[model samples]
Every structure is written in structure tokens, then in C-alpha cells.
Target: MTLNILSRQNTVLNKFIAQIRDREIQRDPMRFRRNMERIGEIAAYEISKTLRYTPRIVETPLGQAEVAQIDDSIVLATILRAGLPFHQGFLNYFDDAQNAFVSAYRKSTKDGKFKVKVEYISCGDLEGKTLLLVDPMLATGSSLVLAYEALCERGGTPAHTHVASVIASEQGIDYVTNHMPHQTTTIWAAAVDEELTSRCYIVPGIGDAGDLAYGEKI
Candidate 1:
């Protein structure tokens, strides 16, 4: 798998990221969700550059113009709640693309460890399509791998897969690269932090994205 770290260069993306990470800014769920959506939009735009395109002619009011149009059929998939806003960003741009959602969560075990369980999925056939699996944060990466596996099992194999996240830990990145299909997968993240708490939360991450964007669960 290939990795693209966007934060290596300074850009407006950092501003969106900073706001999401701000403790005070997290108070406004609206702003938090908006930022995630904006990041998703930006990420989608960047990922577009790597996709295949073909020239096409469009008839304008005055004349016909040639434009390069995306040729790959895209399926935008997300890991439930937290990935919602981020997925929206991609959807805003890939409006015509098919959509998929996976529900995977950490199920605690008796030893205080946890396992990712993919319990729900909603998707069309993924055969020969371009899959964009998106999540707001990549902490342990287990949930992501599980989600991807579940998606493929039900929808068939995609032509290519792009794994996207707003922030990730080194461990998480390493885990996915080793676990995902190396030849057909690419990873994109706005920033990468080096630490993960014992419980598998990214240190200095924007906190629980699902809770921050929505509300604390009971």
C-alpha cells in the first residue's frame, strides 16, 4: 500500500485540522462536523488527481469544449457514525458515485482488550469499482481493516481501494499497510501522530470523532 501524508506541506488543510483538534472548538457540534466535511472534500479533491480520466466533448451554449472526465466508477464507503461527515465531503464531489456504510466498533473482551466487530453493512456490488473507504480517525486500524474485509465479502472485489483518514497514528498506518492488499490500495491522511494510548486512541487526536460530532453515548 502507498501512503500520502498531506500535512508534510503547509496548506489551508492544517487550519481545518487545528479547529477540529481544539478543545474549545469541539463545543460546537456544527463547526466540528463542518470541519470534518471540509477536510473530506479537500481529501476527495486530492485523491481525484490519482484517478483515471478520459477526454470528453461537452456542448456549450456557444461551442463544444473538451473536458477530462473521471472514468472510474467510484463507491464511497465509510465506517458508520464518525466517518459520516468525512464521507459527505467525498460525496459532495463524487455526487454520482455509489455509497456504502460499515458499522464496526470495538467490543471489549474479558481481559480489557478489544476486538473490532463489523456488524452492519449497506452497499451495492463493488466488483471492478473504485472504493474509497473513509474514516475520520485511524487509531488502531483494526476497525478499518475489518470494515474493508466485510465490504469486499459482500460486494465483491473493487478495482482499486483508497483508504482515507483525517488523522492517524504511526501504529495504525503500519497496521493497515501490512494488512490491506498492498498492490491495489492507497492510504491518505491529513496528519500522522506518533502515539496511541494503551486503549488504542490516537494521542493528540481530535478525541472521539463520533462523540464530538454527535453527542456522548450512554
Candidate 2:
């Protein structure tokens, strides 16, 4: 699996990232969601660089032009709620791409541990398609792996999977790297932090993205 961390570079994306991380700025739910959307747009643009393309001819008003156009079939799959806005970013760009949604939550165990369970999934056949699994936060990575497996179980395996997240923990990244398909998966993140809390939250990470984007769930 390949890991691509965007914060390693200097770009305007850093501004949106920093805004989402700021407690004051993040308090504005609208802005928070928009920032997530913005990040998603940027990520989609970067991911496009790796997709396969074919040359095509287009007729212009005065002449014909040759252009390289994307040939890959893209499916933008996102985790419920939190991944919605971020997923929209990708959609805003890949307007014609297919979409999938899966809902997974952590079921806490008595030993301060948890297991992820995927409850709902809506997707088309993923066979030979490029799946962009968008989730705003990757803390434990279990939910992500579980979600991917769930999609494959119902929709068949995708040709390649792009795991997209806004913020990822070191351990979470490691866990995902070990669990996902070695050669067919790639992880992309806007920023990667080092600490993971006992509660499975990324340290210095933007608090519950779902809650920040939507309202807190009971």
C-alpha cells in the first residue's frame, strides 16, 4: 500500500486544514463542512493525476482539438454523515462518477476496546471500478477496513481503492497499511498527526468530524 500525506507540501490547502483544526473556527458548523468540502476537492484533484486517461478528439467552433480525457470509472464511496461533505468535494469535480455509501460505527467492548460493524450499504457493482473511500477521520482504521470489506462483499472488489481522509493518526495509518490490499490500495490524507488517544481519537485532531459537520448524535 502507498501512503500520500499532503501536509508534507506547502499549499493553500494548509489554510483550510488549519481552519478546521482551530476550535474557534471549527465551532462554525457551516464553515467546518465547507472546509471539509474544500479539502475533498483538492484531494480529488490530486487523485486525478494518478488515474488512467486516453486521448480523444473534440470539435471546436473553428477546429478539432486532441485532448487527454479520464477513462477510469470512478465510484465515490463515503462513510455515513461525516464523509458526506468531504465526499461532495470529490463529486463536485468528478461530477459523473458513481457513488456509494456505508454506515459503520464502533461498538465498544468492556475491555476498553471496540469492534466496527457496518450496518447499511448502497452501491453498484464495484467490479473493476476505482473506489474512492472517503472518510474525514481515520483514528483506529478498523471502521475503514470494515467498510471496505463490506463494500466488496456486496459490490464485488474494485480494481483499485483510494482511501481518502482529512486527518489520520500514525497508528491508524499503520493499521490500515497492514490490513488493506497491499498493491491495490493507496492512502491519502490532508494531514497526519502522531498521537492517538486511549479513546481512539487523534491527538490535536479536530474533534469528532461528524459532530462538527452535523450535530452530535445521541
Candidate 3:
């Protein structure tokens, strides 16, 4: 599987990692959220560097100069609640990019099994555009994949899709790699753990990203 795992080696990303990993820092909800946003910001820049860019003329104080600029339009989509801050980070960079949101919840069956139900999806047409789907955690990978499917079902399929996350389990990464359109979609994460809890939590993950970012829901 061609999985991209970013971590401490990338100094800028490492700072965000330290903050998120620090017990005391994680305790501060605002700081915790900001850290997540910071990670997103760094990730956004890194991803942008790889995208197709073309020379464009820009007016300077003295004269116009040619500079590289992103060519394809981008559509930033995030899972609700947890994804808000991370999404905001990408939005900070792609100010003019289209925005999209998806809400998928886990439903437990009578037999103790669970399934992902995509109840809400808000997106513009993604045809011929770049799609960035942000989810803070990737444990079971069901929600992320389902969210992608939901987006394509509602809007048109994207030319390319990029999945972003703070932490992911090895199994979760494998699941996405095997299920997603590998040639057109790529997965990016700061770190990948080896185990997943029975409850579908990544081991040593930053806890429930939604709860940590926005308090607990009743």
C-alpha cells in the first residue's frame, strides 16, 4: 500500500505533533483545537506544493512578475464537529476554494454490530476539481470511505481526492487504500498507530477529536 505518513522528520509538522501529544497541552481545549488547526495549515501547504501550478503574472510595487499559482480549483470537505477546525485551517490557505461538509454517524445494530449512516452532505459540483476530505481520526475507515461515496453520489465525481487526518491506524489506512480509488486518491496522516480498540479508536490517538475540540456532546 502506498500510504503517506508524515511525522516529526518534517519539523513544522513536528511542532504540531508535540503540542497534540503533550498531555498538558491536550487538556486545554482551545489550545488543542488550535494545534489541530496548525497541523492542518502545515498539511495544506505541503499538499499544495504537490498540486499542479502554472505561471501567472502578478503586479508588484515596481513591476509585474510571473509566479506559480495553483491551477485547479479545490473543494474542501470535512466531517462535521471534529473536522471544523482542520477544515478551517485548509480554508485559511484556500480562501477562494469551494467548501463542503459531510455528517456521518455510527449506528449500532440489534446484534451489537455497527454501520455508518451518512445523513448529511453539503457540497458543490466536484467535477474536474480537486477534493480534500478531512477527518481527524481514521480508525475503522468506514466513515471516511462512506463520506467520499456520499459526496460523489450527491455531486459529480472529483478528478482527484485527498484524504487528510491527524492520526490513523494501520488497519484503517489499509482499509482506505484497498477500498478507495488508489490511482486518483491519496491518504495523508501525521502518524499511524498499530492497533485499534474494539470500540474503533486508534491506539495512542489524540482521543476523540470531536470531543477534544468541541467539548462532549450529550
The per-model lDDT (C-alpha) reads: 0.95, 0.95, 0.87
Q: How many residue pairs clash in each candidate?
A: 0, 0, 0
* Candidate 3 lDDT over residue span 1-218, tens digit each: 34577894657788887788787788899998898898889879878977999999999999999999999889999998899988888889989999999988888988777899999889999988899998889898989999999999888899999899889898888889988998899888988889988788888887788888889887
lDDT, model 1: 0.95
lDDT of 3: 0.87
Error of 2 at 126 (Å): 0.7
Error of 3 at 151 (Å): 0.3
Question: TM-scores for all candidates?
Answer: 0.98, 0.97, 0.95
**Which consecutive 10 residues in model 3 have the weakest lDDT in total?**
1-10
Clashing pairs in 1: none
Alpha-carbon RMSD, candidate 2: 0.9
Candidate 1 residue 180 C-alpha distance from true site, Å: 0.8
- The regions of model 1 sitting more than 4 angstroms off are none
